[model samples]
Target: MSPSWEDESAAVIAQGLRRRGFLTAAGLAATAALVAGRPERAHAAVSGSRAMPYPFTLGIASGDPLSTAVVLWTRLAPSPFEVDGGMATDSFPVQWVVAEDASMATVVRRGTALAHAEYAHSVHVDVGGLRPDREYWYQFRCGPHLSGVGRTRTAPAPGAHLDHLDLVVASCQSLGAGWYHAWKDAASEPADLVYFAGDYIYEYATDATSVRWPYTPSLPADFTRQTDTLGRFRQQYGLYKSDPDLQEAHRVSPWMVTWDDHEVFNDYDAEDPSLYQLRANAYRAFWEHMPLRSPQRPSGYTARMYRQLDYGDLARFHVIDARQYKTGQLPGSTVGDTAERRDPSRQILGTAQEAWLLDSLGSGATTWDVMANTVLFSRLDSDDTAGERFSTGQWDAYQAAQQRVIDTVAAKDAGGFVVLTGDIHRNYHLNVLKDFEDPDSAVVGVEFAGTSISSGRDGGETDSGLEVRTRANPHLVSADLRRGYLRCRISHDVWTTQVRAIDRISTLDYRAWTSHTLVTEPRRPGLQVS
Candidate 1:
């Protein structure tokens, strides 16, 4: 006989209570040491013992892959929910090995990194000197406990001839909304790398209407309120990382990650000094959880997130930071087009980033120049009435900045410029026009906006407002309201994008399918429905 829903819920709640109690006790004991200013002793050898709990609860990940290097990451969290992760203030040496095979018999590179308590015992080992465009298996050991093996690959040598590259684009995975069945499906794909555009963790408080609960019956105490402090943000990441499907996705392939507004607050800007401390805390936690190199680490509230990744001469991924340095949104009706929205001084990428992007695009090195963007690049009209409507949170809000980018792409004649976007919890395929207002404007590029992994719970095949919105914006070719990611196959001649979607996310037993296949060619900016 199966357990009833009430019984299952009760069990989950009980587990949360037990974990919370343990965290309270551990926190109190650590407070005394902190107050006394006692120095923490380094435990160089706390091997697997009966007294010590297993520390790889949050799983392991790899990201920021280069031609000869990749970053391997793991956090020591025996009790992930605790503020200290049930760890003492002492640091521990973690041994890491990269193997040619899944079995540990054939080893290539090995090193030991010290996991410090200041960074929540998270270890980021930036392994270098590996062969380019090769697969490598890595694992971690502290004392006697061994972590689950993770697979990562280095990028191809620069300008090396490559036939094809497979990548998965995903974003906006709100833990409380639904289960991550989409991520499980993504892990099964033949992907070289995964680009997590943004919104890795939502900052909203616990939702009463959550469809599924993995760890607890409701959100834990730290996650019951909006995530503002470092401790709360860490707890949020712990909960999100605990998902088996998410962990599997991370374990399978290298990831390229960036942040959206939800990582800090909903529609936040960097101009406000009052929110700088909060932003600082959020940025620090983001770095600790992700598999990023030290150069991308946060210094106070600022971090350099925009960078370029090359896949031989086949493709170039321009990982963009659209939110970090942007000016605040214009004050007025959110949907209505106002004069302030067109102000030249209202910047999105700011001066330095804009210059970098333009210069990178000018470098005609690769066949495909892909933008790993967070928000929609094409203008989206939300209101279909006589008056025009636009989202202030998107590129449409900063018309001058958008125009500059479009002009640069046209002037440079960038090859097959494609933008992979997330954040809006719906899929859209649109032709990026030189001027959104001109219906006959030349198509400068194409944008494939992927839906969320599980943001809006159990979304349908099509939204009610899809027809009106698509009609208002002629550049938009297709739209789907479902929870999933995009599988992109890139070659020198053509680029294909499969809009993969799951039937439902409310239940574990869900079906995934390719809803649409869109293709584009180099120097041919428009998308063709395949």
Candidate 2:
């Protein structure tokens, strides 16, 4: 029989009663089962009789989808900002349910996964044996408390023909900078997927000017300190996940996440052995919070995050990890086009990942090959007429590697290659050229670098430097310094991108609108403003 929402509600009510000392743990479990009107297997699996803390405060998320399966995630954190999330140093069985409808009346799968204390009592259930190209609602139950239901959709079969893919690309959401109105708006849409480009959570404490959580329960006495260790990183994730808007967005759609520098340390790379241990801790905490399977988890300091996910024959997304393997920025200004900056051997994506990306791009049979890349892949020449330079942190620092990737796309005749980027906290629409320094170079693809969710606070509409920046680089289209995300509608014939910007991020006012619309035809590689 299918699960019932009425029963879930009853379970919640029973949980409240248990918490209020009106019922024993076993009595509460039995009462919830009775209220749910479900069999023993349908209700949550009860273990200890001790009163348990509310564990779903961090909310639930689902992601890393496949045709047959997707990962459903939740961390047991009754006291989120506490050192250990208020979870005992033990394991608990978390019962998960997948249904076809939001009411959860039509159940498809139900299973129990052990929430491991070693990994912050988080549960990542790799539920499989499901139909493809459809939506599913899922929820978890522990003791008498039930989590909010999350909606997730699996990708179509590898060779299956499809019409389009609706997606939102977002990045750089610093919790303390502003509100999450952007995420709230995005969650209201019916997008098939969400691409978290990077900076899922900032590592540092809030500054004097930044707004912070008004009610940070369980926060450490010194919660303002920067995150560096495993415990601290886990607390950071917990703090960010506590945001309702972000949790709702994750609850609504499956996300493909790839982290940038802030997820570890700012602008860090694999070149330093000293940072490896810190990276390991950060990576572990990230995996613990995210709805990722075992394959993406860290084995020591190394985690294989760069991988490909094909959305049927319509599109194939190659999610890249730029921060983990790139070399340190060369000694130059943020936008200095030095000879060292253009060094051919300067590494980004390391060696193996580059090869893997090339292979994935070359082998893709889809109409569009999208790179869910963090950091800009295209060049951004400074508007300064005195001297032209580029951001050393981006692909511009290693122009040789950038060109190789673009050349591979061109050489393979890859159709409609698009790069979706985040970081830099701005909106940019640019033509990915064969040689960014040469105006006459062929346009291999187009790039849409989205603005942050709430990173830079409230920015004005007009930037005086926009004109000079675009004039210096002919391929540059539109640039907005505000905070928001990119909404892309992809099809076999055309790709449409909308720059969805938030008018203000400091307040609860959710005044957001599409600032610019751009479109690119299948065979035509350049972008045209709509």
Write the residue-wise lDDT of candidate 1 on 1-530 in tens digits.
54432333234333331111112334334322221222221111222253445677677899989899999999988777667777899999998989787654577899899999999999999999999999998878776556666789999999998899889999999878887888879988637999999999988776555565332433347766888889888888877786667877898899999999899998886799988998999999999999998988999999999999888999888889998899987765365777787889988898999889988984748998888899888898877778888888889998888888899999888778899899899998999998888989999999999999997778877765888898898899889898999998898888999999898877757899998899999878799987
Error (Å) of candidate 2 at residue 285 is: 0.5
Worst 10 residues of 1 by lDDT: 38-47
Cα-based lDDT for every prediction: 0.81, 0.81
The CA lDDT at 405 in model 2 is: 95
Regions more than 4 Å wrong, model 1 = 1-48, 214-220, 332-335
Instruction: Please give, for residues 1-530, the per-residue lDDT of candidate 2 as tens digits.
Output: 43354476445434432111112343334224222321121223233443775577677889989999999999887767676888799999998999998767788999999998899999999999989999998888887667766789999998898888899999999888888888878988958999999999998974454564442232465557888889999888877886667877898899999889899888875789998889999999999998888999998888999988988888899999998777788765475666777688888899999989998994868899899999888888875586876877889888889988988999998888999999979888899887776888988899999889987668766676766787787888888788889888998999999899898877665588888899997688999998
Clashing pairs in 1: 47-143, 48-144
Candidate 2 clash pair list:
7-36, 335-389, 335-390, 337-389
Model 2 vs. true fold: TM: 0.91
**What CA RMSD would you report for each candidate?**
9.1, 6.1
How far in Å is the alpha carbon of 14 misplaced in model 2?
14
